[model samples]
Target: MSIERTPATPDPNWDRLVADLTAAPAEKPVGPVLQKTADVPVNRPDLLGDMPLTPEWVRTPAGWRTRAEVGKVNSVRAFRRWVRRQSTEHGHGAQVFRGMHRTFLWIQGTEGVQVATARREVQQAQGDYKTAKGHHGRRLIPGKEKYKRRAEMDKAFAGSVTAMSRYKAAQRDARTRRAARGALAAAAVAVPEGAGIYLIGGTGGVIATGSALLAFALIGRRTAGGELYHDHDVKFGDTLKLTDSMLNKIYRDAKVIGADEVVELLTPCTLTADGKAWEVTLDLPSGTPLKKALTAKTGVASALGVKVQQLHQAPGDREGRLQLRVSLHLPFTGKPDPGPLLDLNCINLWRAIPMGVNLRGQEVSTSWVERSGLFGGEPGAGKSAAANDLLLAAALDPTVALYLCDGKAGADLTPFEPIAAMHDTDGEPERLLEILEHIWTVEIPRRRALAKEHGSRKLTAAMAAKDPRVNLAVLLVDEWSSYGAAADRRVREEMERLLRLIVQQGRALGIITLCATQKPDADSVPSGIRDILSIRWAMRCLTPQASDTILGQGYAAAGHNAQDILKSQRGVGIYMDGEGAEPELTRGYYYDDDEVDLILGRAFELRAKAGTLPAGSVPLADQLRAVDDDDARVLAVLLDTFDAHLDGEGEPAEWLPGSVLVDALADAGTALSADSLGRLVVRTDDEKAKRPWLGSRVVGYPRSRVLITVRDRFGMGE
Candidate 1:
């Protein structure tokens, strides 16, 4: 390895090569000099031709190549033009070839200088080629082998293609064979056995013509005969010559249409089923166009008699129910005939009972027969039954005490016999009268006392619980007229006093009076009695006057009349509350004997618990009761008040003139003569005269002196 390698003698050609590479006359370096004159000036060829013929640097004695100082190289316009042309023509797509050469040189040595020199060689080659190529259109053209495989593949494809004429000819032959086979098969089945051949015209020709000709030849018929035997084809607009029976059949097949009903259909259509076609020609009804049939002359559908309504005209396939608009001729009305008012089924007289028995058209549910003193009507005109119904209701309602007085000999009041004590003519009237009097003067006070004792202000509870002597008394009198009509003047006076006090004050005391009579004349049924009755039920009376008397002007307005009254029915009545009441004909509940008995029996049971009535009947004990003289005492006081106040007359000295007591006293005393009284016109009380002395504390005024009347008898406190 110590053998020294001798340096090769420097070839004269090497030096020439180095000089040619470093200072090439063919090209110029790129960069500042080239950039300024990248477009070569046509006028500057001299700068490029006059190239320096020396190497850029030479190796000195120190064995190092020195770089030359070439400062500020001026641009040569012609050279730049030449350089630009060379780069554009050859710079692109030449790097790989240049790199290959450089790499080859580098592999020959391992010196730093060698790598750099190799790189310089690659750059110089690239730039020189770029300069030459850029001046002209220079590009690498692919060699013949570059597309050798593609050309081969294309040749193989061309060799494999068949001739177009031959392929088309084969396809045509196949199609011809298929057509021939189809024709042969169709010919075999063309004439169906026992089936007639029919021809239908096509767009240009007729179908089944061959079959018709074949049939004519087989039958040995002439062309005219075949034509005559052929069936005719029917079409639209053909007049159908149908027989009577056929017409009937067609009519029978027609759908039956309902009156006032309409059917709509899609027109200009044909029905197809199982390859058969049927023609349906439509004939509209003899009216306006269907869409406009229900429309008005104004085209607003006003003929239907409804408001302008809009309906959807959408296709029928949509999923929703269709809304139909119709204007009916009229709404519904009820016709009812008020018929006979009688029934054998008296148990529930309220049901199916005629309107006549239905109390002047008043509904039974709102009859008010149970509420006491709420009606004003005739006495015999269902008042008794209404009163009985009220009593029955009260009997059912245990809160009220039932007190019945049949002053008309207890006949009409007998229906209340189960609960109320049925009074007779024996001694009960006087006793009841006395009871009523006590109710006013004593019972009222006693009730007041009871309320005070209990620290409560209500009398019903205090009296009902504490006092057995008084039930919630509803004293019914059949003949309230009897009180005013009493033959005994004293009894009449006492009865009037009782009636006035009770009718006015009995309501809060729970004493309701239900009195009836055959007559409702002024004296018989006074205004005071009528005022208390807010309810009135008048039945068929003897006159219109009676109806008018019970019910005032509004009676007819409530649909009540005298002719429509139920004359024969037991519990029929026209009810009115007062003189201005609207009379209503309503059925008063007519409870039968058994119903009355049953209701009254329950009433009695309740009464017995309240200790209002005895639980059982007594044995045969005919005991005579003694009458109390207190009745005479009460009657006497009443008679005295009536007589003295109403009939008496007197002078001014003894009492005020026109006072009732004056008349009675005068009637009791002898009639004074005017002559006898002139002497001592009236004797002074101090000088007692022969005349029975007047029982009066009054003093008189002196003659010719006016007497002053004083309201305060003795002064303020007095």
Candidate 2:
């Protein structure tokens, strides 16, 4: 049993007690140095009364205000004597060690509070940068001048990103190898007299002492790596047998980088690490900037020969927090392998779709079922490639309908236009606003109505099988910040409201919205929305702050430094799934242009089999069948639709309505019309003459086809 250790509280009458103790003693002046020292024995009769009430003191004019300090000394010695007696009488070895570890960690926590400034600075810097963005609306005050302001923000952001990347890397390395010094030595306990030594030569010790030693040494060493532990002949005890000894040694020698940038022991013999945990908590050295450890972390860890996770070691509590806790899980310098490449090309879409390989080399994946996602990275940082990786998976699913959007000149998204249910690429604020409105007034309500009818919250696969309209509608937006920063006030406000609604309620209705951006700022993506994204991926972020922005707050401090990833490592990033607690460094599956064609081809085959194709969606295979069947007839009608009917005057009209085009095609002996191929793919008026505009007018991508049939299905456009 452990001894009661309730500490004595501060005296309410402290002044009176001090005065009474210091006054001209009616009995004897005990603390005259020699007087008390000579009288107090470890076994004194009043040992209990002599113990120090508290572990603090106040000074006087002579620099010795507190009286009875001498008794404190005797009290400590008497306690040690009592502990030894209890150990001998009760064998409380485990309890004694537990007390030691607890006391040591408590002391370390006190010290750790003193040296946590650098971490505080990092957190503060992150907050301040975000605050500055919020205040400026980040030059949300835009016009022709907006371009210039944006350029300036970009430049400043670049510099900050570079500096943070370096800092994150340094801090990460510092925590990886903090306990790697001190050579190991081992010896067995001494055996009593004539105890039979269980050596190779058990019975013949006196014949030749020196010869026996040589014989034992030769027999004990293993031929493979000369490892003594693996050799049965060796008598050394396993390290586990001496875990307590190892724990004490680690705790005793813990250190931090000192003022002069030198590794200084901060808790030598002052704390005890738990044997099982193998963790040390202790005070950091005074005046040592946490940066010292960050900068010299590699050298210190390498020298110490102990590889530790900086996340475990870098936490701090206060400016005066000199205390830090560190750990080397499984000890030494080993790391787990991340494993083999995961092929996600043909996996079931209902399952956790393969994302990529993570830091531990394990294949990571995310479930798209009822979850929204955020993809964050720098330009050419594999965001497009990863998005395609997702598209490949979704396309393969029978119950998924893709909606594509890109503010870029359309090159990034044009290839997949044929496959999308709703596609938008125009840089026009009005066009994007219209698309959001269509979804808000059309798709959202229809899905909600279906959910109500089915008595379901989320449209599961079973529900989708029963109702074709319950299939997943994936809305993908590229360059999201540009949409938010649009000069049009109406577009900006309305878009924000719809985006929030989609995020808040779309999951239950099978409308999953995923947006990719070059940068994630408060102004670009609302912080509130960013926090709830079920999946977050960051690849090659410019700064640790950006990494945290995508992954969540305090992610950078824990050393998930996605920003440190190099631009060259395309398709490699960190990913967090909704199901997992921790974020992981993952490399997205790489798919080239050719591979995309192949995946899309396979998706076409799968969707054809499942009969989940949207109304008027003609697959590439059907297009081939049309080529063989009614190619000539359809071609003639397509041309007839564009033939000019001078509107009572000689001037030709710029565009014809969908009903007009459909009638003209019917008159030319072609049953197919704009409704059959609508919202699919027509770029120019000249091209529309050849193919007829197949996309909706609401989302006017230069090469989009909008079907009046598809839109009017949801009560859009009258």
Candidate 3:
């Protein structure tokens, strides 16, 4: 039977419903109504409006309004603190004693005799030359005529023999007089036996002794030649005081400004309390550009009688102005202070890590997120030490997973092995390739998935806190030249390709790649990799070209030359963050082995607490057990393979190709593959690798090996 439809039931509500569905909602309540709605706190009152000022805010003073004020305050505090510490720790008493000792040495007539003898010899030589020149003009002919001229010159010199002899006699007499005078002075200062007790007991006698010592010290002070004694690293005296006239003279001598141009001193010359450096802000004369002064920094240093590295220049507030800082002593001469991480138990990877101090004595920090760094310098320039600072920072952060690849074969970065998720120090190209493959295929994809799941374009600390798998990852490759110098061409190419991919794509995924190499050549660190690295740290490179290679072209020309860095300035480097500004000179903090060990132990504990220890987020002991499981699996596969490939006489072959064993393991339903088996056998040569089963008879490339022993010597199995 057909169902009957109610066609007559056309309600007025149908038209109203259609109109309501099609009509736009009343224009979101214009103006104040909408503003009032938005202003209302919805579910989260903590995130709404300006906070009410509390008593704390009202009582707090309005701190420094400008950076200069803050810097000045901090500088004064640091300088005073440093002075107090140095005075106490360095022992000024010892310096005074040494100075007195040096004075005694000088007054013994030994130094005076030597000085007189040197002066006599120099004066006699000069007199003889002058006599010869006066008699027989300065010119000497060439060839046969040169020989004749020399003979004539000798005759003329000989003719002045009487005058030379007289000069020598006079010099000898003067030396004798000076020696007598020195002896008398020494005798005058000698303590009398009768007054020894009084000198030891009486304050007036003490004053007299001090006065005598001061007089001797002043007389004995030698500026040239290393005769003066310095008991401390920093000498407590003004090397050069920059007056307005001195500044003008320096500019004129350096040829940085025109002869008629005078520097307009915007600020008075201020000497640091430590007496090690002085700073001044000044405007260049009209038409004299600041670049001229910058380019002539070496000349300025020369005029100031200091090393080029001692002079630091920065742009002032306005154009054609400069802020000049002159260090009396070479920078980075003092022992480096320990870094902040030395005391901190944990750190946050999202914030900048205090890696170093700049030339201005201001803290220089580096943020790891979304940045890659290239550290290049000579072998002994402390590039490794600088890189270690960053590595230690990563270790302190529980959320950072460290992958250390030391091309120096564990000599440099072995300490990090305990906490690193993956560490390869032998610099086998294929091994590094496998690590990169794992990071690209596994770690990066895992982080990307987490980011997508959480609706984030980049991994955040919040996400890392929730999931350790999405935590920050750092890959540090030290001495990259070792890997680049791989014997296998294909392996090197593959590594470069994988490294480039990770560097370009892994940044947003919280993966940072840091490369350090002594060889700054293009072959060792290809421009392809170098250019992508946003941060560049160039230590004392051998040449400006090498500096340019590390810090990017034109950097050396722009006065950020790493080659100018003195060999003595270890750990000092030119740092560029790719911000298209002038690079900064920074000295990396010294982190010794003991400090590294302490940080590593703390890091291990922190990661344990956070459940982020890389080896499946388990404790170290569990991680070892997991490693043992793999070793056991490999042993079992080898034992089974030996039984499978037996001789006709029921004996296993003494040696077997690694490939043959790999196929047998695959057939036995084990995960061990040829690549894994090769790594096990090939890395046996590495002193750090734990391979009790793999014998020395294993041979061939990293991808293939010939195993020499498969049977147990204990006879537990056939």
TM-score winner: 3
TM-scores of all predicted structures: 0.33, 0.45, 0.54
Write the residue-wise lDDT of candidate 3 on 13-60 in tens digits: 655444443444344421111011122211111111242111111111
Task: Indicate the worst ten consecutive residues by lDDT in candidate 2.
Answer: 180-189
Residue-wise C-alpha lDDT for candidate 2, range 634-672, written one tens digit per residue: 433443444454546664344566566566667765666
Candidate 3 clashes: the total is 0
Which candidate ranks first by lDDT, i.e. highest? Answer: 3
Question: Over 4 Å off in model 3, which ranges?
Answer: 1-239, 465-469, 616-718
Q: Mark the 10 consecutive residues where model 3 has the least summed lDDT.
A: 30-39
TM match of model 3 to true structure: 0.54
Number of the candidate with higher lDDT, 1 or 2: 2
* lDDT values for all models: 0.40, 0.54, 0.68
Candidate 1 per-residue lDDT, tens place, 21-138, comes to 3453445442112111112211111222232211111122111111111111112432444455335313212332343344334333334344455455555555554554443332
CA shift of 223, model 3, Å: 28
